[model samples]
Target: MPPAHAVTWRNGFKSAFWIANVLELFERFAFYGSKAVLAVYLANTIGLGAQTAGSLAGLYSGLIFSLPIIAGTFVDRYGFRRTLMACFAMFSLGYFLIGLGGMSAGQGLVQALGKTGYITSVLVLTAIGGSLIKPCIVGTVAKTSHPDVKALGYSIYYTLVNFGGAVGPILALQVREGLGIEYVLVMSSLVSLLLLLGTFLFFKEPEVEPIGGNPRTLGQVFRDMLLVFGNFRFISFLVIFSGFWIMFWQIFYSFPFYVTDVLQFPRFELMETIDAWTIILVGVPMTALVKKWRPITAMTLGFALASFSWLIVAGSPTVMAAIVGIALFAFGEATQAPRFYEYVAGLAPKDQVGTFMGFAFLPVAIGSFVGGPLGGWLVQHYLRDTMNPAMMWYIVAAVGFVSTALMLLYNKFFAPREAS
Candidate 1:
């Protein structure tokens, strides 16, 4: 027999998830708002050169992943609802500080704190704080949904994530072109406000609390995560899967600069622009067709497709060709997400679902940290050389294809389950 509250929540899951989707839209808008213009704003607006800008942006990205290992615990302890409320509110503050402009923020800070030397550093830190919101919220959503429908629930959530991924960037790009980077900042802040309001009003704690062996102390959670390493299979997967991101992330980290510097695309941004557009148009249909595929098999296909996507840019060397490249990359991402998590949830230790689940993001954070600098360096060196500019992408593609092979091999010999 279900609890009365669980029954009520089940009845309204659709409506409940719709609100989550809307909030996700705004959350993504805030996130990609920064990304859409981050490189351009750094080079053109902040006076950093392309490589410096990419490195700085990469640093921000790396922190987003790094901070969450600890932040997730704080969120879990404080209660998902409280943690979520604070996340949106904190996110709004961070976006405001970013968009207030370097000069404006500098002048205000110098007047109040009697220092301007630290303004850029402070702004960078603020961006890092903003970066922490996504994982925490998504993690919360997962914690809140029920076991049976949880699969459907997360699919809805993941769709919202991709939906936001595409929607936010495009919206921010248009605003950045029309008004300025500052406008995107302002727009992101407003969207943050919408998220805050919606979460405060509509979001609730899951009817079922996160149940585990007697509630864990803060130290115990850390100890449990450390225990994950004892299971070689999970750690091996996280290690091998990192190569996929090493390739996939280049579309964001390196592709923009490549379009502007080498290919001579009419609008350099258009190459990057195609990513969100393709995901919006094609994510659902592709996901539907591939739903029946095995998880690791889908992952293998995902990485292989990603590796292949890069060749489009190499083959034709046109803006339209680059859009085709991004579409290919999006196909890789769409396949990778669902299958990866399904593998994680299904393979969790007998009684450690939530604990095992938290470690699932291990590969992502690792990938971002490694991939960012790798992409930046590859673009600056190999890609900058005329004979090899497109070859940099080939290296990225190779990484993906190699990873796909390695993942299949891991499944065959080392993974928990026998091959289908």
Candidate 2:
């Protein structure tokens, strides 16, 4: 076989790879677009308190990350194309219902559950749909790309993901400003509807040899989950790593309220866009620079950088400062995010690498679950009650600092030397 460098990108990847990635781009676009304004919409338009809105938003995000484990199992059972079609269908319905609930228009169920409950229910539905996307896209990439060019395939995937993330919020800003916040959900629904059609028309399941032989039964999947959870070391690492996401999630959970409510900034979503754009611009070079570092060491540095970024905003409470702070945080994210999976794979038992990797998303779920209420409380206490909003970022930065210190200690003590 020729060396990977000899292979042309056009020859190394199949049509399915391109299709899957394109779908992933718009899926992310739909998701982030709605998410950019969800907190503000909940608090301002739907009449939920800041804390309640945060909690709901957190619940939605947490579910989106957490459900993929089970959802992946379903994808394995059902074909990818069929599962994707169902997922997009749910996405369309869920987003539309959320918008309808926001407008106080649903008749039977909306009236029965009330607006808050209806919206919450729809959010959960939407999250379930969102859960199916990543596994399908990733599986397609793996199946469709030649072994020689799989890494490049994933690089392309990551670039599109960031591109979608950057553009989604910009679009959200336009939609929210021109139409209304609730129409953001409508926009998401429309995007999903288009994706549903695209999937039906263009997406084909990539054929590849199954890894680890035939698919396991749902019973076996559950058993594997239990076995993974039984590994105290793995579980402990996941719990510790969750601190980064807890800090990271604040950009969405609290930063929106801080920008609009505290700084009187109208384009808070634009600030959110800065993080994605930074990652897109800096991620490749940053990855190249740290390609030789130990995973734990890189992660420790990333945690420290992300933590310190909040202090930048806290020191100077202005739009430029917020922009700079978010950019810094994105740099930290770009540094550690790729290495995280590498570290997890190294830590896993060789026989259960896939199982362990599946559980790696746990930290994201845990972070959202915890960070939401914590962010809401910070906003309430520091931003609203005490009238000292800068303290909120201080607390956020402190959380990152503590997490970074813990990571350093973990590297020194518990981390395998190979990983460290």
Can you tell me which runs of candidate 2 are displaced by over 4 Å?
1-6, 107-111, 210-213
Counting clashing residue pairs in each candidate, in order, gives: 0, 0
In model 1, residue pairs whose N, Cα or C atoms come closer than 3 Å (at least 3 residues apart or on different chains), thus clashing, are: none
Model 1 gets an lDDT of: 0.68
- The CA lDDT at 71 in model 1 is 68
Top candidate (lDDT): 2
Candidate 2 lDDT over 1-420, as tens digits, reads 766667678699989888888888998888899988888887778777788888888899999999888888788889899999989999999998877766756557777987678778888999999898888888899888898889999899989988998999999999988998889999999999999999999998778675787776678778978999999877888888899999888988999988987778989999988889999899989899889988887888888889999999999889989999999999999889879989888778888888788788899999999898888788778877778988999999988888888877776788676666
Candidate 1 segments whose C-alpha is farther than 4 A from its true place: 1-10, 14-17, 100-124, 131-136, 139-150, 197-216, 230-232, 266-270, 280-285, 344-354, 382-388, 417-420
What is candidate 1's lDDT per residue for 1-420, written digit by digit as tens?
877666344563544455656677678767876676666665556555556656666666666765676666666567666766676777677666656643465456645643323334644565555555665556656655556677667777766666666666677768877987767777777777778888889977654454666544668767976888787877778878888766656766777777767776534444565666777677778778779998887888888887898877788777777878888888887777667878877666768877777777777666766776776677667655444777787777777778888888888877777332
- Candidate 2 achieves a global lDDT of 0.87
